[model samples]
Target: MTDCDFLLVGHGIAGATLADVLRARGHRVLVYDPGQANSASNVAAGLMNPVAGKRFALSWRAEELLPAAAAYYRALEQRYSQSFFTETPIFKIFGSPEEQNAVLARSADRPWGDFVASLTTTDPNLPGVHAPFGGAWLQHGGHVAVRELLAALAAEGHRAGWLRRESFDWTQVQFDSEGATYAGQVRSRHVICCEGAAAVRNPYFGWLPLTPNQGEVLDVECADLSPAQVLNRGAYVVPVGGGRFRVGATYRWPPFAPGITAVGREELAARLTVITDLPFAVVGQRAGVRPAVRDRRPLIGPHPTVPNLSFCGGYGSKGVMLAPRLATLLADWLVGEAEIWPEASVQRYNALQPAGVG
Candidate 1:
């Protein structure tokens, strides 16, 4: 009978970040993952965009999450002696006059104004693209190499005796007065489920309103275009490591499947055609289900029915930016040092529950 402090279900960003945090605090954590599931974090471009394009509004909690995310990634890079995070500028091309005007109008609001640069009349760097009216530069926003970071963390965890390559079985879990037990290996006091979109299957949290979305990305090898900055038109063309670039993300709701479809490919090609004239080769196609919620906020806290079973999933499209600070908050709450915020806490959805029933 082995004992551990935690049994994390998913090896995606949410689980990886939480495990890293707990391990740093000298708590032993055992992560169980099969490595076959398509996690949204794995498909994510990991770009941290402070200013949202649709509404021209600052991302919810961007002020707090952005800096913390940067610091956290940088610290991890230093610790691992690797470069996983890079500070690249995002060039948001103007799609229409209304979009440009919206950005200008938002510039007057202190913090938002501080993040967005003065709207430019023309783009000098990448021409022949859609820049009829030009675009604005987001100063601090950039991309994190999520794939590299996760791989490195998984390796480090294995070396430190904190990660296991196996799928979690609910039948092996036992709940008693002390806490939860799994496979006769009782470690830590609790188990935090970080199983991205799969959290819908969790009996304790299955009731939470989840609106999962299927997202797809194309890895295109474009040798003609070599811009150092990320290009954003309707879709983003983010430069991954080496000569390869990532272009994508078509959001589909409802009948969501993990496989890439011809419709998604057509959608991406159409969007890419609007932004670039260079011929590109589609080397890879990938899809994953994003654990989006009805309210679009993250669900974090202890399970209502079983107190020892906690959760920290439902990051939606902003997992890279939101994970660091939220992980800290969850860690604090688990240690009984702080109370979870009502806005982000799972209690918000629990409020809709019938009285006396979790």
Candidate 2:
């Protein structure tokens, strides 16, 4: 009885962008992922930053979620031929002089001043790595090699049979009034729990207010740097293309533990030894968790008490630029067309709970 209309429970990146937006609206999802060994969009380095730094600001909805998440990952790399988004460009290295006068006072107050640029002291392309008080490019920041786009969208949803590698048995999930089913073999009318951070063990969305965080990364190789951008200073090297380099990220919170820790590899090798003494070659080390939400936004809707059980997740560090416009607004609010992001509704935490609490 493997019927389906939706069952997606975490294939990461918000259940592979809501199963490629409900299979491009033809609708008939099934996905049940147990992949990425406990996903955080698979130890993400899938950065899509649009201006973010200690106080450089401007990332929250960076201009309508960065060109609708780069035209939805270039239309899923032209309908699964596969490339996994690239666009790269993000230098941002300025150790001081108050971050080089905070990028000329944030480009004379344009806020993100058109993705900022022009501010250099010169490194003539990688001379011994560490730049002196100069760096600011950002131009359409990019990156998304999330494990080769979640292994090519879980091998094109298991060659279109719609995927189901295992582990999603909430007691074989069953709900009446003809809607949810699962182990009874997928009779789903709705049930989207893009369980990143395991939606805190979702019992109809474990009481909402999640704040998980746990990150940790490092995969150095750094073949003497080049114009391969994405290298913000205090942790964030990202280059990953042969000469390798996907350094860092360390953000623990609440007793989290996705593994890797020796105090997070000595706090990302002491922030990559303050920019670079050179000689790199770590190889690998990873960790997950990040389904953050402490007003960092992103929780999506439907399930104050389960109306077909919906929920995207708290996209902590901008899950690859807010999971394709909140998975096309949670597949247009599950087909009824629109309306949801009222600050990522979950009825805004049911209007701050209380009144007969639940």
Candidates' RMSD to native = 1.9, 17.3
- Scored by CA lDDT, what does every candidate get? 0.82, 0.79
Estimate the overall C-alpha local distance difference test score of candidate 1.
0.82
TM-score of each: 0.94, 0.35
Off by over 4 Å in 1: 125-128, 241-243, 352-358
* Worst ten in a row by lDDT for model 2: 349-358
In terms of lDDT, which candidate is strongest?
A: 1
Per-residue CA lDDT of model 1 for 249-348, tens digit only, reads 8999988665999889889988888887777788988898899999889989977767688889899989999999998999988888899878898878
- Which residue pairs show collisions in model 1? 3-186, 3-187, 4-187, 4-188, 5-188
Show the lowest summed lDDT stretch of 10 residues, model 1.
349-358
Q: Write model 2 residue lDDT over 15-109, tens digit each, in one string.
A: 88878888888988888877766467778899888877777788876878899998989888888788888888888787877777767777656
Q: What value does the lDDT take at residue 264 in candidate 1?
A: 91
* Model 1 deviation from native, Cα RMSD in Å: 1.9
The segments of candidate 2 whose C-alpha lies over 4 angstroms from its true place after superposition are 3-6, 9-12, 17-29, 32-45, 48-51, 54-91, 101-132, 135-144, 164-186, 193-229, 232-296, 300-302, 305-308, 313-317, 320-358
Error of 1 at 108 (Å): 2.6
Strongest candidate by TM-score: 1
